[model samples]
Target: MTYSLSDFGSYWAGGEVLCVTEGAPREIAFTRDARFTYDPRGDFAVNAAYVQYFVPAQAVDAPPVLLVHGGGMAGSCWETTPDGRPGWLHRLLDAGRVVHVVDLPERGRAGFAPGHLPGEPILRSMQEAWTLFRFGPAEGFADRTPFAHQQFPVDALEAFARRFVPRWQGTAHLHLAAFLAVLDRTGPALVICHSQGSETAFDAVATNPNRITGLIALEPSAFPDDPAALETCPLVIVQGDHLDSADHWRTRADRWATLADELPDARLIDTAHEVASGGSHMLMMDRHSDQVLEATLGHVRV
Candidate 1:
């Protein structure tokens, strides 16, 4: 179903803007097409998460859903699929659910401060995304030889790669702070996190479980250090296909399963094992994303 601005009643955003470091006082000037000239030298605000929220005309009773994208990606990943189909954000909005999408600090709309953070930003190549995302093997990445059950719309892989952005490895703590600040604004939310974002999600909920009613992890790459901290929060862990075929994914999946087993309120959804397969790491953008999301939401009691 198509929707317009009329579908929503209001929208807003909030997050922490941190300045870990400031550039030396240097005279830097710029102009906009020579029509406007201005001096741009000042302390740069770094590691500020960008959050965009949409409130429907009639919202469901459920808590707002917080959608956090994986590493090297922005919140836009939840807005639309590479094939131009409606993503989880739109689907949730269509279902009368309030939705908040977050672009983690140091990425996307949340600009990064050069020379502020420790290490340089790492850029993900097309081949890396092809393989790391479980669409295909590393050797066959150049040829784009996706597995038989690949469901990431391989034809649009190039378009999807466009979502890739430079990500910092040492800024997890900063991202965590910004995420918590977001929760401080939207109380008692249901967080749905993907990949590295899952790490921050786990940390956020662990730090403030009362603010987060539930969490849905999408192919999470990291798990909480203390599982007991998340005992009160409802958890759902979802994984895609071919995990056993790759050590990188297999280890993480196994670790996540172990974490689920330890948590009293945690549920595991291995799409490959439970369903008819064809699910990729990018489960939200997969061919059967609608079903996947529906099933996941069914498990989220809060």
Candidate 2:
């Protein structure tokens, strides 16, 4: 498929309204004569999400899409694969659909506020990602061994690892708020979210069911506390392969299945169930990424 864009834009959304007390006046300066009292205590806008959107020249009569990336990642995940291939952003635009990709607060272009959230940032190593993302087995990370049927671009593993950013555990609410803010602008839209982002996306739909009509969850790492909230939303849960190889994914797959069973309009597409050789956790970056995406898109009417 080919891609063309009539327009492109970006913006920041979601932030906290702050109230502060003034500190004792202190002198601070870039130069001796330019010295002035710099009070660090004041109202500040903290933790806002960044969004970039593309408008297809020839548009289809369909809902615009809002993509939310997974944990320790940014909107770049949808821009291109580690191997320098086109990603979901271009693919969807090629199909005549409008797309908005988001960098959740505290990741990517979204700036983080100092001392606002608690706890130090956590960083994931390539070795950990190899196992955590199911690119390969943990035991074989040293030799860079991937699963026999693994479809992730193992050769570009280092490039992929470069995208990993520091994450905080206390930002789920912030993430949800940011997603909700984006939904406020793009209502009745299709939300395509991956991994940890799925949790926030799920809650966003639950919170704004009228605005978010459909969902495409890729290898979701978390779910909402109440499954019944998604009764009115159409959901497609797409999982990668080798789920049974590790308890981490095995448990997640089971939860996804159970959630699908509980929701009337929900379905699960586990690659492991569909083919002998399936995809990895990074479905959009996998070799069969396009096919997986097309299959999932088929379920989204809006």
Candidate 3:
């Protein structure tokens, strides 16, 4: 059965409206609290990572696809396109594959506490995403000039930006534990990940290759210190344009270059080099996300 956007966002927990404004023009007086550490701050409750598993009614024998978001973002990345269109979450499900979308620990509805989670939130600015995400030139970010044929909806930048969550740097182990738990329940599956979640993907795939059948990393980094183990599982790195400079892609080239030499079995695909229509770093959210999704599905089913 096809899942609706509301169906994906229905899971809720771990917060309350402690105070509300009482006056002619009512406003939120304040919230209960953003921080929820192990040591209770006042009848606090922690939420499980919100995961929506979309399994087609006529299921394929393929392994389930686990969709993980990058830093400063939540599982909503897969829910819908900036332009109010069905995103990869729906596309993959329609392709007859089971897909699991996640809001990892301390993100979205997963719950969080500042000092308690072992690291602080790395707040991101609009310009940071604009430039870093390869939307366009630095000046264009301020002026909102998108690259020619850019897929991301400029109109939805505000909503897209809202999904940015605070990244927890020192909590890979926590993410790993959560991922492992998911795997234990789902059984071995194909793990598709983005930027920061790459770390968790590699670690999980490496430590338990039997549980993680494959990995398709999009503009990913933080590859395991030792990538040799990644060879055990099917691996593919799908990279998009580094329009600004080689700095971003250069570092990635160097890392993957080394991995390629060491493990000739691993594969890499540069979208700009192959596809007639190039994509940005946030390729999956772009207008032609299906092209990249096509490349992703090709390698995963095995």
Candidate with best TM-score: 2
Residue-level lDDT tens digits of model 1 in 7-98: 43322233334443433444434454444433334444566678888887767798989999998999989989999989999999888888
lDDT of 2: 0.87
Better of 2 and 3 by TM-score: 2
Say what the RMSD of model 1 is: 2.8
Cα error, residue 238 of model 3, in Å, equals 0.2
Candidate 3 error regions (>4 Å): 1-48, 243-246
Which regions of candidate 1 fall more than 4 Å away from where they truly are? 2-42
Q: Model 3, 141: alpha-carbon shift in Å?
A: 1.7
In lDDT terms, which candidate is top?
2
TM-scores, all models, native as reference:
0.90, 0.93, 0.82
Model 1 residue pairs with clashes:
none
Residue by residue across 151-214, what tens digits does model 3's lDDT show?
6677687777887877766777767777777777678888889888898888887778899888
Residue range with the least summed lDDT across 10 consecutive positions in model 2: 270-279
Per-model lDDT = 0.83, 0.87, 0.73
- Model 1 global lDDT (CA atoms, 0 to 1): 0.83
What CA RMSD would you report for each candidate?
Answer: 2.8, 2.5, 6.6
